[model samples]
Target chain A: MALLELKSVSRHFGGVRAVDGLDLVIEPGQIFGLIGPNGSGKSTTVNLITGLFPLTSGSIVFQNEDLEKLPTHLRLQTGIARTFQNIRLFGQLTAWQNLWVAQNSPADWAKRGFFSRWLGGQSGVREEISQLLEFSGLAHRQDELAANLAFGEQRRLELARALATRPKLILLDEPAAGMNTEEIGQLRERILKIRAQGTTVLLVEHVMELVMGVTDRIAVLNFGQKIAEGTPVEVQADAAVRKAYLGGGE
Target chain B: MDFYFGLAQIIGVHTLLGLSAYIVLLTGQVSMAQAGFFAVGAYAAGMLTVLAGWAILPALAASSLLGAAVACAVGFPALRVKGLMLVIATLAFGEAVRLFFFNFDYQVARGGVKLGPLGGEGFRQIRYFPENGWTTMQVMLFIWIFVVLVMAILWWLDRSRYGAVLRAVGEDELAAQSVGINLTAVKVSAMTIGGAIAGLGGGIYAHYTTHIEHASFGILLATFALAYPILGGLGSVFGTVVAAIFVQGFLVEGLRFLGDWRNLLFGALIVLAMNLRPKGFLDAPTLRWIRRVFGGKRGAA
Candidate 1:
């Protein structure tokens, strides 16, 4: 069974048809890459899956559960998390606090009464937060506000926050957007490490080197529709994919 | 000393109102309904004790609960709108509640014989301390104790995960939602808690003054409450506390020496404050400085 399945998903922003008749299946523990030209509905698909926007038609199934009715927060509780294409950390919060807030689950909130919750949980939460800070290489700078961090560090902090959710499947939207080569290499290693930990990844990137180097399977989209899906080499050689990228004579 | 104590009591009550406003502001929500909730608390406690013949402590509790109920009712729908629309919705709700209480009519009759008019004209001459055999000093002490308790609770919340989440929601609702924070729940809870705190203040205000009037909890009071958080700096709880004390406690009262010219002085002060320190006197930088002086670590982010 697929970890995530989107069948004939369509979203129309007043006839714009941002994502039209899209069908996709992401297997469990697989690193799936979604790529497309500008305006090819890549981000829209991510939004639809995460319930950021209501789908005009169709269904999204996650772990055999229909996600049509769940709100974005509920979807997140069900072990799905994502990073924004543009970084959106809580700028006023420290790096440690950013990850700490993300670690909150509805279950944790329900477990204790109001006063206990206000006092914050036991040592477990603190330990987990420390681990996440160390994992993101932000332990030394964890006290710094997120807005003060360098861009690359902010991106890493966001990734760490997503991981703190303990998500079953994580979505990365252009994780390597404005990074140097060294940073990209680090991010690739982190993604591989994330996959090794048994969490499935759905990466959406315009950075071909990162996508091709890291993803197990790749899908190409053009004009709100999937144009190709296969291994990286097969997708690279597909005639339609080549035409979509290089532009044919219509 | 008595005069200073009385002034301190008034300041403490306003501080509670300011804290109530601070609660909603923490979620980046601008609600001008604190006066409405304050009225609910005042009337509920007053009527419960005077008419229904209940004890003071129980009446206070009931008032707080009623305030929370009214807030949740208003918040469920009011919070659905955002920015200025939400402000308008809350303001309208506050007016509607005030009008409801103003026009309320209740009469007790025995066998068609008229008893008394207990509604609409406003509950007056509520002799809370005299009738209960309590001293003004005791009541003042009572109000300040709760003030301290509330401050402690807010301080705890400021350091907790709940506070972090509220700040996140305030900073960026979209991003907060993306992280799985329940925006509606966070917002509604903030409103409910804020209303309860204001209601508690109202109960104390009614008992302390030994009177209740509909006109006292008007739009002007609500607007001043809103200004506390803005002028205090929306960044921290300390900002609200300091702003409420300086503005409501000192500045407003201290300007009375100028008599008729006080309003002009107050207006000028506000304008200057807006121009000179738009973020309020007790903002992040100032807070950091205070922390540094006290040898305390960890910024108030």
Candidate 2:
């Protein structure tokens, strides 16, 4: 069975069919790329799958469980997490505090009573957070306020926060959007490292060059419908994807 | 010299009143009838001590119990409402409670049936605990201790996951709901906790004041309570208490200099606190910059 599947999903916003009759399957551990020109409904598809918006009409099955009905957070708890196109970090909190909130820490829950979790302090949660920060290379700035971080660092921090949730699958929406080429190179390495740890990744990116380098397979969309799905090399040679991009170039 | 010390002793109520107002302010809700509930708890303790001839220590303990009980009872409905609607509801409840004593006829006297404090003449003799030197002073000490303890507990709670979730839910309901924080529980818990603290303060206050009158807890008291919190800043635990003491103490103690202008001074103070620093005392981040210019230490948020 596919790790995640969307069956006949469609969404319309006041007579504009943003996504229509889409059927897609992401197999276990595949580094799939969802690519299209501007306003091709890539983000909407991610939102729909993450339960950010209720489907117009569809069924999304994640790990054999129906995910269309679950809320975004419930989906997160069920080992599915996605980063936003626009960063949504809790600005007032510190970097580690933001990361800590993303992870479901079992520290002194009143429902679970006091003495049981009182002794389970910062050291335990700190080690896990430290490791994730280390992987994302954000450990140095862990104590800083999230809002104060540089734009590139903020994107890296978002990656760390998503990893903190320990999701089986991660949906990254333009992790390299505002980064310099060197920063993008670092990000590509980190994404590869993240994939090596057995987390399935589905990336939605506008950077054609970025998608071509790492994506094992690419699905190209135009006007909310998938027009091409093949290996990166195969999709690069496709006439329709080239026509779609040429019609709406960066 | 004796008058000054006595005045200072009386001023101790300012500290407790400030703490009570601060607690309600922290969670963005106020029970204008706190003074009413405060009286209920206080009267419960006073009646137990004077009428039942119970030990003062046990009576004080009973007072807190009565306060919490009354809070839970009143909180049942008041906790569900919000903003000015809640303020009005608590105000009416306080008035109803205060009016019940003088307006309603009571049958007292170990089985003798009489109605009203007017008809029941002998009750006045038993109204107050006999003036024991320094007893009021000792109650004042307990209030200080309780305030410190409450502040400490609240500080820890502010750093906890429960507190974080409450904040999360408060800021963005959609994000918080997505994170699975219960909005209803956060709202009610804040009200109950704030109400409980106010009630406890009221119980202690009863012993210090040594009198219970219908006019004692009016809408003015509620307005003053509301004003104390706003002047300090509503969200910060530290700011609210400071603002509370600043407003109440200045109006009460500073007024000796200008007898007729005390209330005018109070209104002016609220206006100043709100206008100069709308976030209240320490709430404005701008204050930190001001402090730095004036050679003061930086404060935490």
User: What are the per-model numbers of colliding residue pairs?
Assistant: 0, 1
lDDT by residue (A23-108, candidate 2, tens digit) is 89998788999999888999999888878788898789999999876766678777777777887665655677666656642321
TM-score of each: 0.95, 0.73
Provide the TM-score of chain A alone for each candidate, in the order shown: 0.95, 0.92
Interface RMSD of candidate number 2: 3.9
Writing each residue's lDDT as its tens digit, candidate 1 over A1-250 gives 8999999999999879888899999999999999999899999999998998899999999999999999999999998999999999999988988987887565656765665554573344677778888878998998899999999999999999998888899999989999889999999999999999999999999999999999999989888888899999999999998888888887
Clashing pairs in 1: none
For residues B72-137, write the lDDT of model 1, one tens digit per residue.
888899999999998888888788778877886554443564322245667665666788777667
Prediction 1 global C-alpha lDDT: 0.85
The 10-residue segment of model 1 chain A with minimum total lDDT is A115-124
Interface RMSD of 1: 2.3
Separate DockQ for every predicted complex: 0.58, 0.17
- Give model 1 RMSD, 1 decimal: 2.6
Q: How much is B43 displaced in model 1, in angstroms?
A: 0.5
